[model samples]
Target: MLVLFLIATTSSVGFAQIYDLGGMYTYHYRDGRYSDWGDFSLHGSRIAIDELNESGVLGGARIRMTNENTIDYHCWPENAALMAETLMKKGILVLTGAGCSGPAVDIARVAEKYKIPVISNGSNASMLSSAEEFPYFVRVVSPSEQYEGYLINVAAHFGVEEIAYFYTTDAWGLGARDVIHEYTQQRDINIAQEYSYPRDTPYDEIKSYMNKVKQAGIRHIVNTSPTPDTVMIFRALHELEMNEPGYSFYAAEMISADEAPEVVAGSLGYFAPMVELVPSPKLSQFRDALEKRLGKPVDPSSKAFFYGALSYDHMLAVGYAIRDIQDAGESVTSQNMMTYLRRMDFDGTTGHVSLVRGTNDRANMPIQIVNSHGYKDNGTTVDFVSVGRVDPATGELILNEDSIVWPGNVTTPPKQ
Candidate 1:
């Protein structure tokens, strides 16, 4: 029952052959301290390759995943240029998962100059999609800037006034903080106080900042730190007694169920552009088959599934695009793949994905907030807040035609 379906079945068309595909390396910015987590981008990349191999999508096409060593995130742009150059020289077909915004944009520039196809797993800054700058880049994740509007509306909807910005000192956090700051100002709201800490910061160093957060007389907080820093913030809040009622916290892009729920447990809430709630029959079948293969339940938030799903969809897109060009007897080159990607569309785990020609040019794929301590398959455990569709222009969240407010939700804690 192994059938390889081509987009267009023609006599000239043939079952796609895996032509020595490899690579999918991640470049991290933090000093090598967090290397053990491996790159989150690599997780989605691995899942794509593994699923392809198992499903016989390419009829046993081989794909290799690797990593680029770097101690700093700023070095990612240069590191990405280096990795793309080395791999392109070796004839690697696709480059996916540039860990964050700077590196992702850099990789896209390099890929375009050399005509290599680059897809992003994490680089959500809107600028990457800007047509004037990046012509060869496409990311499965929605732009982080668009999500800010959702953040503001979500906060406003909950009657949050005073807000604090607790962000990591990195490209992703800085970029988002800048965008959210601009929008919030344009809307006539100022951040009560802004606090920052570097990655791998000691808890002692954050105490004063935590005190400032407590003293801001603010009722809400917006954090842009990664998983570890996020955990530390929550732990600090507990010790500082900042987790009590009358205060709430909002975060973007770090809601994987893999992390201990305690990080966000007592907080009011957190937000991300999207979470894959709509189970794709394709995704479910893939999940079931993967569980059977691994002989264990896969961590839904594990890098394995994220990168794997991204990579699988990436290749599937490539496969369809290639078939389209091949039907016209056109040569399958990086340049043509780039052209096809802009026009190709299909359903995958993340939802409907497409491309536009400018930085921050991508559409906001609806919003979902989690109120639970952790994600789950059971219906009763997870409480979802669909905060209406975000109108990117003017930075406003239009209440959904039918918004559902969960009963007995967590309330904000009063500031000391």
Candidate 2:
């Protein structure tokens, strides 16, 4: 599911003066903790704006941007909706973020009420794809279907017949769960059982769930739950010594092992997104520049393309949409921006992006497959590496290696 978006106009290359456009970054996670994707997306937007100003993409016009941090953790959009209302009251019609799924829904409600445009990297629930329901909404990220397909394709490829599923109850989780339901049926992979938790589920309950999981005699578990919940599950398994052997756990969260490196060795695999092993020079340049700018190492797991870039693409999409509107001699307003955005398509740091097909989805970005390579340097290092890629266009599962490295140094899919 998407968690971010914004809109703006484009300028002729010959334009030499800076003009004003309203832009703001809005985000709210379910809890107090921040989102890696959201933070990196903000970074991506700034870098894109920097490049736009430098290139005079606005025909002597530049964007003046601000940020809104909505404080809430229950997926309640009241705080974010209020934030959007204030921005609209202040005459800022175009906005780009609501990085969490739940808040995105309320932000869209505000956008529709204001009769303005809102491009978001927010909620990725497939239901949000309805233009009739959310005409003011747009997403710059790929659909949740792509990630679900990644897991399904790999599982089927390894001859896995029955798998277990663990998902959350929120929009992102529901969207992915729906995708998984459809795909598993298509692939003939039986879901042996399913489990779930809410945004505020307690740790003891998670431990109790693991007791049930162990009793179920399941081997392969497909996890698309929230990061914290997954961490708790994995830790419970580690303590229970369920990480012993013949247990396979895979998740889409790239940073799953960061906080609990000790629990994730051998058994965990994940979707390695947005970064190319053979980095392009342009991507390399952007990474270095951003790393230097951030005063630290830049991680690509939060990426939309290179270095987990999404807002970069969304920001560029805004510029292109705005330019298209201006080319038609139209003033840049919410309606005008939305209209042009429907026809605007561009290739940016996030690969191919388009919303003209009547959907706010990115097209043709692959989710790279990753397997835990096992840690080295005395179990301090978490070594999850690229093992394959699931192409979005072709739906092919291509593995880099002949065999996968499962937990406990087992180099094969755990048998049922």
Residue 367, candidate 1: how far off, in angstroms?
3.3
Which of the numbered candidates is closest to the native, going by highest TM-score? 2
Tens-place lDDT per residue, model 1, 1-416, is 12334435542345445443334443333443342123433444455566555665443234444443212243344465766666676666666555456566666777777777776555677566575577777766667766655676566665566688888766666777887787677655668888876666887777678777777666577777665566677666656767555666666644334444444443324454444435678777666655665576765544345545554555556555655666766776777877776766777665565555443233444344433333445522223345455443345466542333221133332333
lDDT of 2 by residue, 63-125 (tens): 656544222233444476777777777666467655556567677788889877777654556
Candidate that scores best on lDDT: 2
Please list the residue runs of candidate 1 whose C-alpha ends up more than 4 Å from where it truly belongs after superposition.
1-17, 20-22, 25-80, 255-268, 299-308, 357-364, 372-416
lDDT of 2 at 152: 77
What lDDT is obtained when candidate 2 is compared to the true structure? 0.64
